[model samples]
Target: MRLYIAIPCVLLALVFAASGIAGITRGWVLPENRHRVRRLRLYGWGQLVAAVALCRQMLFSTVLSDPDTLDPHIREWGILSGGALLLTGIILMGVSQRARGARQGTGTP
Candidate 1:
């Protein structure tokens, strides 16, 4: 269904964004291109968050409709996996913000 396309899209995006960040950190990027890279990272993160939310919502709807039919282990795994992904994405945003702040020379206490 929609997930067949959505999941891979998100995974591919995340991989691409992570690699882009690595490239930037290693000075592969030009000084003037910093803002563009930051924007791309934010867009990638938003896509990832939306995809996770969509998955969690789908699982919730499915589980509630046939709670007894689906395996309990699956329900547990889905909840855990979705939650972890959401949290990780949020934390990555925080790290990204810190990096941006440092670049602006306003990150120090």
Candidate 2:
């Protein structure tokens, strides 16, 4: 079960991180709003952070199965940091999405 979850998490992390790097370095993925450089960077950073948090959560799950192998304090910190990053990333992405939608006249403000 953990393996199944881990596989998808790893794949998503890779995709998001790659997209983030491309967006930050070359602005490759923001085809719809190419003019919004700041928003693009924000979205990219959000994706990167989200990817890291996802990987961290995946690692935590794996470690949780064999709790004796790792320290409890470390696991606690991992969960805290992962949750915080995930939340922050999601918020940034949401803001970007909302801005894009408003610009496109989607009435998403």
Candidate 3:
């Protein structure tokens, strides 16, 4: 069960990190607000960091322990923190995409 959850999280983390890197290097920007590029880059950085933290908590921390033997507190903290970061990364990415689309007149809100 944990493996199932971890697999998807790892994949998302990779994607977030990759997209963030591309945004940072390529300077993804909106036409309506050139100054907003800085905010977008910051969002990218946030997503990248959140993704890394999520992956670490979900994959590395959980992998070594037997489910039965794992401490509840550790498991709770890992899941809580990982989930929070994952949610944050997803939200940031979504906001960036929407901002881009809105600027491009793609009807995104």
Candidate 4:
């Protein structure tokens, strides 16, 4: 069961990492889009942090004494931290998108 869950988590982390790198690289194509590049970098950093947290949790899952239970403080912290990281990454990306849209006159402020 844990293996099944871990596989998906790892895949998700990999996707996040890849997308973040792509965004960071894509930001460099134009000189006038400096702010867009900055926002993209911010979003990318957040996603990378999230990916790291998820990978850390997955790596530590095996050493945990009770994989099925969340009674351990360390395990609980890992879960909560991962959740927080994921949320932060999503929020950064959303803000970046909104800013980009507004700048393009396609979104309302």
Candidate 5:
């Protein structure tokens, strides 16, 4: 059961980190409009960091004991912190996007 859950968590962490790095490097993270998007890079980096932390927690828990029945505290903290970080990164991205949109719509540049 734990293995099943851990597998998906790790996969998601990898995807998040990869996508975040791609977004930062490719410069396609923002909208098509060339308006000011504050903290876009920060959000991307945050996602990457969050993904790393998540993976670390999962790995640590797995190493501490049998993957099938790891420590509940570790699992709980990992899931909670990881989910919060993901949400925070996404919210930052959204805020940046909204800023860009506002600038574009208002012709503020």
Candidate 6:
């Protein structure tokens, strides 16, 4: 049960990071185009949320903690997911900015 939850959580994080990269690559061709990026961005963020929730579940699945002290595996998973979320968020933000600039006809980097 715990392993199952952990697997999806980490996968989601990786997916988030991968989606962000895809969005950036797509954005490069047409900076103003936001349709694909918007959809992918939502997926990425959703994955991050799911990852956190799933990871929390894995951590507390057995001897559920009230305060949720960090178990070693939980700590590592959390850090990985958090980093992926942060990186994806940053990439999405940059893409959004570029989209805005392109829409404004500025084409700012």
Estimate every model's Cα lDDT from 0 to 1.
0.55, 0.79, 0.68, 0.67, 0.67, 0.50
Provide the global lDDT of candidate 4 against the true structure. Answer: 0.67
lDDT of 1 by residue, 1-109 (tens): 3556556655665565555465544534335545555544554464356456546745544433366766777776776777777677666544544445445566778
- Any runs in candidate 1 off by more than 4 Å, and if so which? 1-43, 61-65, 100-109
User: Where is the poorest 10-residue window by lDDT in model 3?
Assistant: 29-38
Candidate achieving the largest lDDT: 2
Decide which is better by TM-score, 5 or 6.
5
lDDT of 6 by residue, 1-109 (tens): 3465566655775664455455444433234444444454444444344445444444544233333565667666655675565566555454544433335556778
Candidate 3 C-alpha lDDT tens digits along 45-86: 666877787786776465645768667787777767877776
Rank the models by TM-score, top first: 2, 4, 3, 5, 1, 6
On a 0 to 1 TM-score scale, where does candidate 1 land against the true structure? 0.44
TM-score winner, 2 or 5: 2
Per-model root-mean-square deviation over C-alphas? 7.6, 7.1, 8.8, 7.6, 6.5, 8.5
Prediction 6 TM-score vs. true:
0.33
* Residue 40 in model 6: lDDT: 46
Backbone clash tally (model 4): 0
Model 3 TM-score is 0.54
Return the TM-score for each candidate structure.
0.44, 0.73, 0.54, 0.60, 0.52, 0.33
